[model samples]
Target: MKVVIVGNGPAAVSAIKAFRKVDKDSDIVVLSAEEYPAYAPNCMENVIRGDIGDDALFYAGGFSFYEKYKVDLRLGKEVVSIDNKKKIIYVKGGEEVSYDKCLLAAGASAFIPPIPGVELGGVTTAKSLDDAKRIRKWILEGRVRRVVIVGAGPIGIEDAETLRYMGLEVSVVEVFDRVLPRMLDKHMADLYMKPLEEEGIRFYLNSQVVAFHGEDGWVEAVEIKKLGSDRSIYLPADMVILSTGVRPRTYLVEGTDIRLHVDEIKGRVVGGVLVDEYQRTSDPDVYAAGDICSGIDVFGRHRWIALFPTAQQAGAIAGYNMAGLKVKNPGLVDYNAVKTRMVTAGSGGLFEEADESHTFELDNQIIKIFLRDGVLIGYQFVGLPKVLSVNKNNPFLKDSITFKFTGQGLEASGVLMHHFMRYRDRKVTQKVLSVIKNGALRSLANPSHDIPLFSL
Candidate 1:
């Protein structure tokens, strides 16, 4: 069997790994729109902050990763479209690839709003390696002194922290009332923001970017307005970053018969290609994973969580199913972690609309849990690495902690996600909550054991 995969990120590589385990004899061709190899998406900030070398961005230091895997790897090949009937893929340069089956893990792209002057030279998105290089260049060149980031989502918050760490004046403008609105509650958002604020980063919540102003085609400032008022203010910005988050890259199948779940707002493609639990799309021979697809959330509704781990899990499942192993990803609960030198935080599932919510705040950590009709709905946590773990200074965390870190080695958020994922259990979840209520979210999970499969 010749399987063609349309992507080069975590999802595509995961599919390759799983497929190899099941059917090594099948010919696997991986196509990447970028000239680079698979790199961790979350590590982009590390590169921008000059912690990791540029060459380290690509897995295995270069194309050697593909060579080692014994797969046909095609770089700089952007899949433009597909002929579902012929099972043929069309690249941007008119190249065609034929396959018995295909996987569309095309991933996502930064969402650029219709704001004017975005074409200015100093404006970029925090989405790709190229964008990271651009931002780093401006900072290293001393060309940017003040950076205005639009949106306080994960990317935006991270970029703000990175620029500030690099000694640039950073300001964030978020449309929502709080930072990480999708992942954290207003109170927990304050905790995450506190560190950045202490580092001198500024935040403008409940605000929107109106436009960019530039001279000589390079950004000079950004115009923003409070959501409830007509007054607008211009913030001086040597560079501007659009960190408004991302949308699924479902362009290749726009005219194809493959179905997509569209976001009602602006009629945009929200969920990319629709797929069953097996990652099989409407087209039987085609499967999808990563940001290019959506699955059921804890609420049994469709959601697109464009995180690296989510994509990786989805990719593995897609690969297994494609290789005839019959695995599945019926649904997922949101889980994510973000760490900087200053703070580590993460959240999962629903908030805002939960029927009952509880908060436990200590000098060392803060944890919030939400539920609807006695069912775990959502959660959030924020604190320093030491405080999140066994803290002798705090009575609640003296020794009961039995936790394992996840997602880029962030332990605090790992604790949050661990409890968040397993909290559905009648016994395990309540024990976790009770422990936190008494002292801290001491770990109930054994690091030696795998995350319970039921959590997925």
Candidate 2:
């Protein structure tokens, strides 16, 4: 068998290894548009700030790992189109690669909203290593003084922190009422915002960028309108970074037999490849993973969530199934942990995503666990226990006084909650809380288990 993978990120890398594990003799080829080898895009911040060098950005030894795995890795090559019927992939240089199985882990591109003057020279997106390199160069040369970020999501907040660390005046504008609206609840988001404000990073909530003002083809100021009012304001900026999330690179499927999933409630076609539990798309010979594919949301509906770990797991499953292992993806769980201004905040599963919920707050720490019929479904946390003062009346505070959950806390919560979903017992919430209090949360580090958290 010959396998052609359309990306070289974590997904493609894992897929290659998985395929080799099941079918060692099969030929594997990876096509990457990027000149550099696979590196964690999430770690690009440290790379930009010089905390870590470019060499440290790679994972599992980068491209050399693929070479050692006996996979043909093609760098700086773009897969333009796929002829499913012909079982061939066309590359940028008019080269065609024949494959028995194709994996479209093409990933996503930074979404640049159609705001006016957005094409100006001073604007850029933080989607790749090359982008980080360019931004770092622009900063080290003292070309940027005042920076404006157009979104308040994780990427936007990260960029704000990094630029501020570089001594640039940073401000973030978000159309939502609060920052991290998708990740944290309003109250939790406000808790996370306090420290960011203290760090001198300005946030303009409920604001939408209408246009970018440019001087000599370079962005000079951003024109934004308050969501509910006719009032407009211009923020003078020497550089503009668009951290406005991303959409899957679905354009690669254009004219292929691939089918994009449609959002049932929104009545719009989802922006990713639709695949079954086995990660097989409409074309039997083609599979998709990573940001390019849609997976089960916390609500049990297909949703496009582009997170790194999910992409890796999905790719592994896709590769396994492609190798005829018949493994099934357990679906995706929403989880994210972001550190801004040296403070960490995390969320897992649902937040205001369900009907019933409970909230507990103490000092800088806040925990809001979502539940359905007495079973825990999700939770969110803002600070560490050492930073949080114990509240005597709060039952959840007893064991949490010195509790130190690892970074895996957020991702583990989804697993525990989902497992509890099977039992209809009323003690579901109490059982999960006990598990956390007994320090069993640490056991979630085991690779096999799905992993939760608080006092009842």
Candidate 3:
């Protein structure tokens, strides 16, 4: 069997490893648009901050990984066309390769919103290695001092932190009410925002950039509009960066046999190439994993949750099923963790703005849980680490819960329990349940055990 996988990010790497495990002799080819090896996308901030050298950010595997597995690793090659009927992929360099099975792990691209003067010089999107290199060069030239970031998401926040660390005046403008709105709520965001603002970062919440003002060819200022006001304000800026997050790169699959699903509220291609439990697309021969596929969350509703861990899980399952294995790709849960001088992690569901919530006291910490119809749908931790762990593993807690920790013992949370449960086939028992449930209790005897557990 011949397998052709597009993109060299986490999903593609996982797929390659899975394919080699099942069908070592199969002709496996990886087409990567990036010139470098696969690396963690989250490490972009560390690289910019000068904490870790750029070389260290590359994925653990080196060239030997491909040579040892006898896989074709094509770098700097773009797959532009897919002929479903012919089962072939046409590359940008005019190379056509037929594949018995095709996997689209193409990942996503940075979203650049439409705004006047956005095409001017000194404006860039921080998404790829090339982007990093260009930004680094601009900084080194000592021409960029005042910076304006157009998004207050994780990437934007990280960029602001890095720029401030480099002693540059930075301002982050967000159209949302809170920063990191996707990963954190308004309260949790305030915790991080305080520290950032203290470090000389300016925030413009509920504001939209209408135009970019430039002198000659470089950006000089930005025109923005604040919420609840019609007046526009101009902010001085030497450089502009767009960290508005990303959208699934479905342009290649557009007008093809593949279908794209749009989220009505967001009006973006939230999911691509709808797949079944086996990760097989509408066309059985075609499979998609990672950001290229639309997946259902823990709520059993269709939503796009694009994260590195989910991509890895989806890719492995797709590879296994493609190699004639009867493995069903367990759908993904929307999970994310953020730690910046403090740690906060959550999974499954979110405590939306339109929800009724309750707070409880645990030792010296406070645990706030969000419920919808008596189910523990979400939670927030803002105290001791021990208390955070206790709330994280509450048996009565809903499958979708978010936990935030302001103290040290957060690591002890049965965070790994869910992953272990998924990968292991052993039965769960009362003893195991007791251990997790009575984690906060010094005594296991006469413990509050409401559920029966099985042995492993």
Candidate 4:
């Protein structure tokens, strides 16, 4: 029994571990296009600002973990295509690998739009560990001072926060009217983004980058135009990061018998290869996970939630199904938490579809709870960093007051919402509101007490 996994990410690592748990004797081979050990994608932000090497972020405890599991880990081997009919994978360099079963966890890559001047030397995207290292190298070499981030997504904002912390002039340009359009609505985005603006991270909303102006084939400035107006601005830049978004590496199955699902959400295409509850695709011998595959959400909506936890669970499930454990994925909850020095924010589930919603505006915190017929359907919690407040000695304020204590609230909400989805009509929303209410009251009474506030 020989198994081949297509990536070296969270999904692939979990799949390998889970599969080994059931069938240790099965020969496992991992084919990763990256030339390094499996690394945690979430740590890229911190790693960028620090002087640590890539080895510090290995997902499966370095190569020793693969060795302990008796797995064959092939580096820099990009699977160009997989012939499902023949149960064979074709590598980019004409290498053919045969397997009894395969897990398509090839993950995703940063989507750099076909905008002019994008090929300039100083332009990069925050998708892989190397991307972070490159940016860090430029900063360390004094090559970066004015950083122009081309998108206002999580990657861009986080990068802005880090750069701003390092005393660099950071600015974000978003075609959308607000920041974090996918995770937050306009109003919520305003609340969370306001403090960051105060922190000196400029945001250009309702604008599009027309071109990247550069000299000597290296980026020098960005040319942007305000939509619906004859307004243009040229912002000087030492570096440009395309934080637009990501796309799954789907070329491997493009001409194969394997199926794919593509759909548009909020004007952006967000779909991948479809997978069942067991992580099985159309082909029985082939399974897919991670950002490469879309799974069912808690609302029974078949959508792709490109979050690390979701990928990890999907990989574990795919591994189980491959090991003959007949398990079904419990479905995903659309949840995410973004933490910065200026603020912390988290949102999840159904926001607009939820029938009734309530909001509590407390000191330096904003919490919104949405319910669909009394079920925990949606929520948005944000909290500003205490440093941002003018009243440094406010008697009712604690040290952090989250937006963890902000992003951690989302993790807490995710757990509670999962219970609601599992039990169905469990009346969990009321209990959730109670917890939220208690935090609000605690903030009003004594701000010094550490309460999460379901904060930003």
Task: Report the number of the highest-lDDT candidate.
Answer: 4
Candidate 1 stretches greater than 4 Å from native: 54-56, 262-269, 298-300, 384-409, 427-431, 447-456
Per-model TM values vs. the true structure: 0.88, 0.87, 0.82, 0.88
lDDT winner between candidates 3 and 4: 4
Q: Write the per-residue lDDT of candidate 4 for residues 1-456, one digit (tens) a residue.
A: 899999999999899889989998989999999888888887777777783564668857899989988989999998899999989999988999999999999888899989899999889997798998898888888898899998998888888887876668888999999998887888889988987887778999999999998989999999999998877799999899999988887777888867777565455446888888889989999999999988887677678778888899999999998988988988787777775656877777777787887787655567787778776677777765564333345332233332212444444445434444544444534444665666533332233432333231
Q: Candidate 4: lDDT of 23?
A: 92
Q: Can you tell me which runs of candidate 3 are displaced by over 4 Å?
A: 54-56, 262-269, 342-348, 353-356, 360-367, 380-456
lDDT of 2 by residue, 214-239 (tens): 88998999999899889889999989
Which regions of candidate 2 fall more than 4 Å away from where they truly are? 264-267, 297-300, 362-364, 384-427, 434-456
Models, CA RMSD each: 6.8, 7.1, 8.3, 6.4
Span of 10 residues, lowest total lDDT, candidate 1: 400-409
Q: What is the lDDT of residue 98 in candidate 1?
A: 99
- Residue 223 in candidate 3, Cα distance off native in Å: 1.4
Pitting candidate 2 against candidate 4, the one with the higher lDDT is 4
TM-score of 3: 0.82
Q: Tens digits of per-residue lDDT for model 3 on 1-456?
A: 898898888887788888778887889888888898777777776666555764567774666667877779899888887887888888898999899999999888888888888988889998787787787778878889899999987678878767765667889999999888875678756755765676578999999899999979889999999987889999999889999878887776765777666677898665766777777777888888887778655555666667887788888888888888878765576555443322333323557832566544445333444556544454454333321332433332233332223542233322322423242333333354344344442222222332333311
- What Cα-based lDDT does every candidate model obtain? 0.78, 0.77, 0.70, 0.80
